[model samples]
Target: MAFFGFKDIDKLSEVDMAIYRYIVDHDEQVPYMRVRDLATGAHASNSSVMRFIHKIGYSSFPEFKVSFQTENQDLKNSNDDILTMFTRDAFPNDIEKTIKLVAHLMLDADNIIFIGMGASGAIAEYASRQAASLGFNCYAMKDPYYPLVQQLHNTSNNVLVTLSVSGKTIELVEMLNNFVNSADTVLTSITGNIESPIARIGRYALSYNVEETRIHKYYDLTSQVPAVYLVDGLLKELHNQDVARRIN
Candidate 1:
């Protein structure tokens, strides 16, 4: 059961638990079943099945199935190359688009604010300093007060860049939601969980697909490599644009 140990089964709703139990019990059959079929087997609603998939940290059912297969195959093959895993899992298409978007936003915004906590906060700080070196007026806000002050002053010409592995950090999500509801600030997020609440709130969301397992759950092995890749890419693009503008 790949999904088993990645998520706390006890925390799931009764309907979601039913769906999860059905999937685990019928792991071999689940990959072939339709959403409705799974719902029927679990005695849960179609919506419950969908929600269960997202709740278990997958953007979609197909993605969930693919991750399950990939993880199982990797285990059998004993694939242990971390760099190869990062390269294989990173979403190149989304990465390019996200870099372009970040560059464009930075060019037009009066100020840029990077926000995060924990490991992501450190990444945010590094990204902010990098952006500053590129001549953008940017700063990282690990504390809540600075962002709140910025929000109080002016938000229309500001961009908020948030980083989180789970995309479900309660504090970050609440703050982002407040900004979205109250002002015209541009919001962007870098996260591994594409379907998470903070990811959904961001006007521009960039995601990297890292398969979670029991090891990651206990060890907190979420990598900042993807986020660093994004920031570094964005910086390069911004520099190129600057050079192009000067030449023009």
Candidate 2:
């Protein structure tokens, strides 16, 4: 049977194919099962199960589970209206809490560093400039001089805002890993995939569930819209809070 877009399943060894068939047939239970349990259920070895996962292009079982769950949910809700999907499903209630948290982090931080790669880099620059205009010490780090600036800056009170549509951008993930492992900095991520590596590593992760489409491969048209909305909402809330504090 065809799995996702891979159609070469028939060529797998008997044990590996058994494991694949078990996973394909028992999609709901697969997520909950450990590697050993899955191996037992498939009458295959644990190594075989792991090998199958690798052959399917996943780095780990958890990552595979995330992709599997997403794909399954998408298939079930394939007919939902696109507008509703973005406005309702993508922008959930937790977004407000996330925005509030981000605003608070920005307020408490001594310096804010916004980082992104490719299209997200533009968003980072825009957000950094906007925050700076609001009297915050912020900089958008996209230049090749980022390493030098980071080395020179005091990172203890720094808040790093990373934007990535995929959340798996190598540069962002590497930066986050370094920041989190070495410094006393706050790491925040805005991304489309919540289960992505960068999001998982972040102290505060705000994600939007944009429906993945074929158009995304050729052009990232709508992925950044929700992120922009989140930033706008956070800025407005911060402004409102400041006005209320002054009034009080």
Best by TM-score: 1
Model 1 lDDT per residue over 15-85, tens place: 87778778778877777788899999999888889998888788888888888766655664675674475
Superposition TM-score, candidate 1 onto the true structure = 0.61
lDDT of 2 by residue, 151-246 (tens): 636656788888888888776676667666646688888888889998898888888887655474767665577888777777787666666667
**Candidate 1, lDDT over the whole model:** 0.79
- Candidate 2: list runs displaced more than 4 Å: 1-85, 143-145, 152-155, 213-219, 245-248
List the pairs of residues colliding in candidate 1: none
Off by over 4 Å in 1: 1-82, 145-152, 213-219
**Deviation from truth (RMSD, Å), model 2:** 18.2
* Candidate 2 local Cα displacement, residue 123, angstroms: 0.9
